[model samples]
Target: MTRAKVLLIGLIVLALGGVGYLGFEALGVRGFSAGIAAQSLLVLIVVVWTGSYLFRVVTGQMTYMNQRRRYREVYDAKEREDLEARFDALPEEEQQALLQRLGLDGDDVRADS
Candidate 1:
């Protein structure tokens, strides 16, 4: 999820929890809020932090994608160069024989054979 979405969701959950805890404490049911508005501010701080964390993760993923694409281009170029080097080393007669066997000399190699 996006940073904004994460922050919104976290804030919602924190608000619900705080309200539930407050209600519980008032009813003498045992709870965790400490009964202070300032304490609830922690929820906002954490939500903002989590939002920044999520944004960093998204940017890191994009960076990885760009690095991977660059590596692929380099690898493909090397492979093509290697294949050309090997092909060029072959005798002209062998190269012609290979082309003929590949059916490149005729549309109907089987009929000709």
Candidate 2:
């Protein structure tokens, strides 16, 4: 993570801690109990956030995984195009021979199909 992100997160946590403390105080909790309650609230929030992230990962909904999937699709498409171009550049007799060697009929080798 970047330094700025770390600093921002630290500030957020501090703010949440203050809010938690004030909330518990408003409920008549004081001193050590209020401090503990605030800390527990923070821990609960962190646990829920982490759990949601894990759920996204396990369900294959993560942005990083999506990006990698898109990259693979584009790379495979380019590779397929390159292969077709190379095959098209071959002499007619060589193309026929290749089809024969591969046991693929000329009419059945359309890439889109």
Candidate 3:
């Protein structure tokens, strides 16, 4: 992701590792075993977190995706409005001709309605 996010994750991992190591040592596990235990704890935590995030995404529970979808809908609506305005600006004969060419009834496509 971003550099800042990477740095923050690194810091969080380091902190977790340190806490895990100390916690294991306090429980009478020392040296290499403590280090391994701490590392394993970190791996487990990361795996669980990643799985949770993936589940949310797969279920469409991610807020970012929802926001993007909403933005796209709004953008599409604005584009449609702009196109309709341009079509309305065309001269009456041209508008009628365009509707006939497109097989649309002029009365049904009027902007005033």
Model 1 misplaced stretches (Cα beyond 4 Å): 1-61, 105-113
lDDT of each: 0.70, 0.93, 0.93
Question: Tens digits of per-residue lDDT for model 3 on 30-101?
Answer: 999999999999999999999999999899989888999899999999998998899889998988899899
Which ranges of candidate 3 are over 4 A from the true structure? 28-33, 56-68, 107-113
Instruction: For residues 14-74, write the lDDT of model 1, one tens digit per residue.
Output: 7866775677677675534345543565567667978987886787755667789799999
lDDT, residue 49, model 2: 89
Score candidate 3 by lDDT. 0.93
lDDT of 2 by residue, 4-111 (tens): 998998899889999999999999999999999999999998899899999999999998899999999999999999999999999989998999999987787875
TM-score of 3: 0.71
Q: How many pairs collide in each candidate, listed in order?
A: 0, 0, 0
Give the lDDT of residue 58 in candidate 3. 94
Q: How do the predictions measure up, each by TM-score?
A: 0.39, 0.80, 0.71
Can you rank all candidates by TM-score, best first?
2, 3, 1
